[model samples]
Target chain A: MEEVWVTGAGMTRIGRRSEPLPELMAEAALAALAMAGLERPEAIVVAAMNPEEFVGDGNFASNVASHMGFADVPTLRVETATSSGAAAFYTGFAEVASGLCSTVLVVGGEKMTHIATPRVSELIGRSIDPYERSYGATMPALAALITRALMARHGVGEREIAAVAVKNHAHAARNPLAHFPTPVSMDEVMASRMVSDPLRLLHCCPISDGAAAVVLSDTRGPVRVAGVGQGTDTLALRHRHDLTSFRATQTAARAAFTMAGFGPARVDFAELHDAFAPFELIALEDIGLVPPGKSGTITLDGETALDGRLPINPSGGLKARGHPLAATGLAQIVECVWQLVGRAEGRQLNARVALAHSIGGLATNNWVTLLEASR
Target chain B: MIPTTVAGIGEIVSYTTLHSAPEGFRSPLHIALVQLQGGARFVCHGAQTRRVRIGSLVAIEAVDNIYYFSSLNALDRARLFWGRAGRAGDRVNAMTRSVVRRLFKGGESGPN
Candidate 1:
């Protein structure tokens, strides 16, 4: 198999948009093509979850391909809930690495703002077991429970969680495409309305409508996909022995690091799945980037800031970048690619390698990808 | 209404904890895959119980917002007592002792 490099990347401004899903996806695809200096792609992979429910349309991949003028190219869809973006990128990478295609375009898009908030909550809750849903165990409820457990077990507090939101929002202030670009104070985060006990409204990623795209080629470039790993666990959280960590994420990260021939100590930066504020801390531990209970110290010390030693979520993460479900994972990859190639603009960090981590459905499925700069 | 029939129901599958559950929910909640008669499955929460055994055919009952299925129903009690006509009368005898204890504790003394 050959190595795969990200030659181009683009994302639509993540916010509530009146534009249709296909149009938003097309815009991102065109932007990526322009960035890559290519007019077409050999293969296309679209990542969208439940477009039927969210946009009243199916065959979303073909629709997007048609809109982007890739009508005759081989196209397919990939869906793994919030990790759909990463999953699609993995597929595209495989296509290029296996010599099936020289270049592949991976696009992840979602139209979540069209639905009502309650309906969105209901749809997201469906990812949980029906029995859990009956007991009112929504995603926020689970995250809240996990947050409380982490706090009690690891001595993490609301202040640490608030620090994550504050830093991400501040970083987003320089990102023109971010939905929530306004920096928030820790006090504002603490005072935000509670969605589920420990998790407040500001702690959760917004219901966003947007798209992100990346072009991958066999030609080596400034940034290359050094490693990719994905793993899954039981969807029902009750079956797991531990609640404080995601076993799937740990396993995926371990495999990714092994494949990349590097460990956390060698990594310069990371983009973690911060669907909820507390998740960043949990993910740091799971991914072996931080010690078991010391992630709180990192957050409290502002180590995750854009200018910190090991900056995290310089694209503002889901907390500020606006998580459009399937699009979030690909967006993380785009951010890492930008940073690795010195194209992150305002939020660029002095880093040569970065890791993008994404979790699907409460960490049941996890995908970790490593991006390294070519010497 | 979809008029979906209740198929073969299974016991509680699995569940998780909601430590930060609003006001009421706090304990490690139990969730199950209730298999309906028509092969359709629905996820549900199990009622508060000391123990939940697999393959235990529990009767489903609803009260207000919650649903429960347990072996402590009238039909189960009758099957344990009157239906077991011969060999193992010891199980009935033990149940009788429990009823006596309940009566002594000023609780309802009925078989169910």
Candidate 2:
């Protein structure tokens, strides 16, 4: 395989927006291409978790490519539910790495704020196992069940879980592109309305409308795609042996580390999928960045904060960064690129190697991608 | 595959009371993940979430293609039997037929 480098990364401000899905994606696409100093890529990999349901558009790859004025480019759509963006990135990475294409553009986005909250929940909930969904298990419901199990098994407290949201929101306050870019206190997060038992509204990422894009090429660039790995598990949550940790994430992290030729200790900072706040702590342990059962204590102790020893979610994470389903995975990668290149303005941290983790449906599909500044 | 069912008690592994339910579902929906005594596990709806504790045993009932779980009183078990036996037989039969058809078509084995 040939070497792959991230030439450029761009993303729109996440949250409710008036633009259509294609337009939002085009904006990010254009920005990324401009940053890469390229008119268009040899191939385009588009990702939208449920554009047919969320935006009433099918044949998304062709739709997005043409809309972005790359009408003749080879295009395809890649999806793994909520982690569609990262899946698209992997496709683009393969296209460049395998010499299928010299350059590729990977873009992902979602539009859901246009729908009612219940309807949005219903649509997103479609990702859940049908039997579980029939039991009225929405995303938060399933996450709550996991959170409860995590608490029971690890003695993780409500305060510890709530701290994830607090720290991310504080970090988001420094991020102009964040959805909830205002600081939220522990008292406020703890007092937030309960969406699902043991998981409050603050713990949940909002239904957002946004897009993110990245340009990849075999040519040397500022940031090298050090490693990328994907992992999948049984869709039904009941089939898994352990509820506290995600096997998919572990598998992906293992592959990523193997490719990077190093262990987790070398990662300077990370952008974690905190779609639900507890996931941050869970991802930390699953990726071997933190010792098992120590994530909660260190997180609550401010070790994962922006100025801490190992900053997590310097992009505000999916929590405050806004989780626009498919857009989230690419956004996380874009944030890593920004931080590595010293573009993450106020929330910038001293970093070189960065890792981005994304989860699809209920931790069933996960991806871990590592990046390093090409000095 | 042959059609079959598991009837027994299971412990609630974890549960949640959902305040903002999906469309066509009522708010404050109580859902639980249960691991049966025989080791089979599934998600089930609950009538009440109050007093429900993790590791507490609850009986499972199949009615209208959905599983309902709770700590049952004698009256509750009788009501479940009556509902499953005849009260909703026609509708349950229709759903069961669809489920069997889906299974034959290489779909999910369990009813949605």
- Chain B vs. true chain B: TM-score for each candidate? 0.39, 0.58
Which portions of model 1 miss their true places by more than 4 Å? Answer: B1-112
Backbone N/Cα/C clashes per model: 10, 0
Highest TM-score, which number?
Answer: 2
Estimate, for each residue in B45-94, the C-alpha lDDT of model 2 and write its tens digit: 88887867766556767766677787856675455446666534543453
lDDT string for model 2 (A1-375, tens) is 999999999999999899999999999998898889989799999999999988899999999988988889999999999999999999999999999999999999999998988888888889999977877788899999889888875547889999999999999999998999999999999999998999999999988999999999999999999999888899898988678899999999999999889999999999999989999889999999999989999999999999999999988899998999998999999999999899999988888899999999998899999999997
Q: Please give the TM-score that candidate 1 achieves against the real structure.
A: 0.80
**Separate DockQ for every predicted complex:** 0.08, 0.32
**Candidate 1 chain A weakest ten by summed lDDT:** A146-155
Query: Per-residue lDDT for A1-375 in model 1, tens only?
Result: 799999899899999999999999888888888888878999999999779899999888888888887899999999888899999999999999999999999999999897988688778777776665667677887776567557655458889999999998998998888989899999999999867665788888899999999999999777888899998898876556566789889989988888889888878989999999899998888988888888988988988788787788999999998899988998898888878888888887888889999999888889999999886
Judge candidate 2 at residue A69 and give its lDDT.
86
